[model samples]
Target: MTGQPLDAGTIAELPKVLLHDHLDGGVRPSTLLELSDAQGLVLPADDAEGLASWFVTSAAAGSLEAYLATFDRTLAVMQSADALRRIAREAVEDLAADGVVYAEQRYAPELHVSGGLEPQQVVDAVTEGVEEGVAAAAGAGRRIRVAQVLTAMRTGGNAADVARLALENRLRGVLGFDLAGAEAGHPPSRHAAAFRTLRYASFPVTVHAGEAAGAGSVAEALHIAGAIRIGHGVHVIDDVVLGEPTEDDPWGVEKARFGDIAHWVRDQQVPLEVCPTSNVHTGATPSIAQHPVTPLLRLGFAVTVNTDNRLMSGTSLTQELAALVEHAGWTRDDLRDVTLTAAWNGFIHHDERAELVEDVIIPGFTERSNGRHRA
Candidate 1:
């Protein structure tokens, strides 16, 4: 894969797979304004551009707790079934426009019950919206697949119930389960029973760990909570010990030694749903250039790039990849590798994942490069 660095336009045309996107966090600013107006709720900004800028500024508060506070506004208008359905449908449409071939939308159903909605009703509304979004995208000549991953807030007390909801809807559209929220005081181990239930039922689980905390948080997510994938697991790099660079290797990655947790993560090929821009905004990492995604990828840690929250970060998957190419000196091969990693690690069944990689992702990249690289 040798040529000029891929620009954002080229990256936007490549088929990509997303594994870690928040439904509430990705609501369109214009939609938010409309919903808030219908509810007679005051907002910091009156227009879409200002509202979008406000979210980006608020999310860059340099702490997970402060960064998460911006969601109060998004969640404020997302209480009713109609709002959830609209937001979910628009999310799929936006991703399709951005050239995402597959995506898994995640949100905590318990958060939407304040408007007198049952958890099952919330799921039904979102599922309906996803179906509609898929059909709409297909009509517009954009083929995409969207699935749901039911999330349980780590600080909330209803994780067990969320797990049950995921199992009940597995055949419908729910593909997996997740635990998200403040990762410091609320560890994944706190919801042991929820993990136990999901594990006993042979369900896939991904835990948000090693973001606000360190590698210890990642260990608990993997060992105690039985997560097959780690969300924002950048801090797993904390356990690595960097050694001196050798004459043959200037980057020193060959000399870097991994601790027990890091070794296990790499050895078992546990997928890391890394959000580069979101990590910078939340102070999880310093910047895109210094992000551990590159190093971890070089060390064979199964690193996959994602847009954790598209609106909050003021970004899309294309922009995320372009940033790596511009600031991190990433090449076309790096982009392909991460896209393939994400496709293979998606929550769907093994055969479906293979079809996505073989039929969609590889062909898209191959055609774009004009046979410059072989998959």
Candidate 2:
């Protein structure tokens, strides 16, 4: 039931769930310019549009390390409570305007402490910002839910501290814990203590894997680190070997094969937060069409679409969905399915998840789908 590509209006009206966004990575360009000025920092581009282009182009350098280098500029400006709070609030407002009903935004508190602020202080500031943004969005007639996901840098040695902080603040809007950084040499096992802590506390965990590395990284994330979800587990495709169809089987029912890792991921129904544009920007795949998400979805692996970094990828949830609709021939049903997958896999409570599925996602997509049909 493939439908026509989603238009901007319909895309903007569709309710979405974002499970893998980065708070620091999605700062508003205009806000960055202002923050940079306040900090007396020099920016590569003078204007917001130019800075936006610069970020997109630099991220498109086709390597994770090169892509991460762009964060130096953003991180530099995000050292103070005011900057963090303002950016975090802006993130919530922007997501709400783009029709995101719920989001789990992640960032490393340790990265923001260079300005003589403590880790808890940084978290407190961002949380207050998110709360303020949510209230402001409500006053603007947009209802949205957002939670912070405290992230531990895989290259750093503070995973345990980060994990403990996340646990300590879970009641205050910190929904989960995650590991993010350069993924090649720094494996999830490097943060085993943090994952162990989360596991002991029964907290949710997601780790970036298979984006910069391969199936082994994902395997460690699942087996060693006990991650409930995988961030860009695209390279799990590397473990899959598609078989050939025969005359006896016209439908190719037995033509697809999976290695143990892929089989485990699929059988376990571990959600893959697939960020298409960002995957392309990081060279995880050559293009949107070549991304493993469609194949994984068809094979019954739990898959959810996300915009990993709105600024870096120059995308929104709407843009990410539109890209898949245009390039992958995804129908509106496919979009709904991925939204449901994300809502289900979100780090929020089960009752809230059910409420979102019933009260927002399902009904919102249904309305849009019906409107398209009537038109």
Candidate 3:
């Protein structure tokens, strides 16, 4: 069944699984202002509202590198252990409040050590914050689980170090490793050593590819670097050749021809962590209505919705799904399917992922569906 379209409030209450949120990108505006003032950092906007507006405006620069430049301010303030902890804690608490039952928040440890804090110290501080946020959210009647995915900047030559850190803290709070940054010139193979280290240890790895670049970057991420999940894989659409639409199929997804990489990705069911609004902001896609997410989803790809950056995109997970519903015609079943796919592909163990799906996600959707029917 296609199911009915869900309103924003109902969508907000649905149990969500977020697999690709950035820790630094979701910092509270007020917190950024307060921290910037404390650190004598000159921010473009003094007030929280102005700063929030500035982020959204600046991030809509129509390119990934330009979009990433906005992080300088956020990263500048995130040098201290206290700032990292506070940001991480607030990220978890915010996700929990938005009805996220499980999330993997990612950040590069190397970026946060500019203030002389060791990489290990950075992880420790964020872990403490995550624990605090989980406890606080539970106390507030919003139970959520959050895990860290240590990321290495593709240009930073420390992927191996980050992979080691993630492996060392696998049981602590870290669950995965990732490579993120400008995707144009820097391909995933640049960090092959790190991906190899993680793969040898059986650690989950997701690579940022096919966003600024094209499908070749995605192929390298999968074949060379061995990433289990692809971040912002919107450009994989380039490899797909669409056929003429007919009466039976409007989008022509059934008749579309997939290139080898696309066929492998779909046949193997590799999850794509798609951030709709963020894609628009980075000019990865023209707009939400025209985004490749809908076509990719209809084509039977393992697609999951995410808010890559809440502050920059001015979005939450709820808003991201709502946009898809309104602009892309996503229904309740579409939401449920993507949610289940995300839960199934989570970096957690098989049993834990099953528990999240069976115990949390499925029940949450069923309850909401029933409530709507009764109403």
On the 0 to 100 scale, the lDDT of residue 266 in model 3 is: 93
Write the candidate numbers in order of decreasing TM-score. Answer: 3, 1, 2
Off by over 4 Å in 2: 1-4, 243-254, 372-375
lDDT value, candidate 1, whole model: 0.91
Root-mean-square deviation of Cα positions for candidate 2 versus the true structure, in angstroms: 2.6
Query: Considering lDDT, where higher is better, how would the candidates rank from best to worst?
Result: 3, 1, 2
Clashes of each: 0, 0, 0
lDDT of 1 by residue, 60-128 (tens): 989888888998999999888899999999999999999999999999999899889999999999999
147-186 per-residue lDDT for model 3 (tens digits): 8999999888999999999999999989998899987778
Q: Provide the global lDDT of candidate 3 against the true structure.
A: 0.92
107, model 3: CA deviation in Å?
A: 0.4
lDDT of 2: 0.89
lDDT of each: 0.91, 0.89, 0.92
Colliding pairs, model 2: none
For model 2, how does the per-residue alpha-carbon lDDT over 1-375 read when each residue is reduced to its tens digit? 235567766878889899999998999999999989987899999999999999999999999988899999899999999999999999999999999999999999999999999999999999999999999999888889999999999999999999999999999999899899888778777777888888999999999999989998999989988999999999988888755646654323356788999999999999999999999998889988767887788778899999999999999999999888888777887888899999998999999999999998887877777774211
Query: Pick by TM-score: which candidate is best?
Result: 3
Q: Which regions of candidate 3 fall more than 4 Å away from where they truly are?
A: 372-375
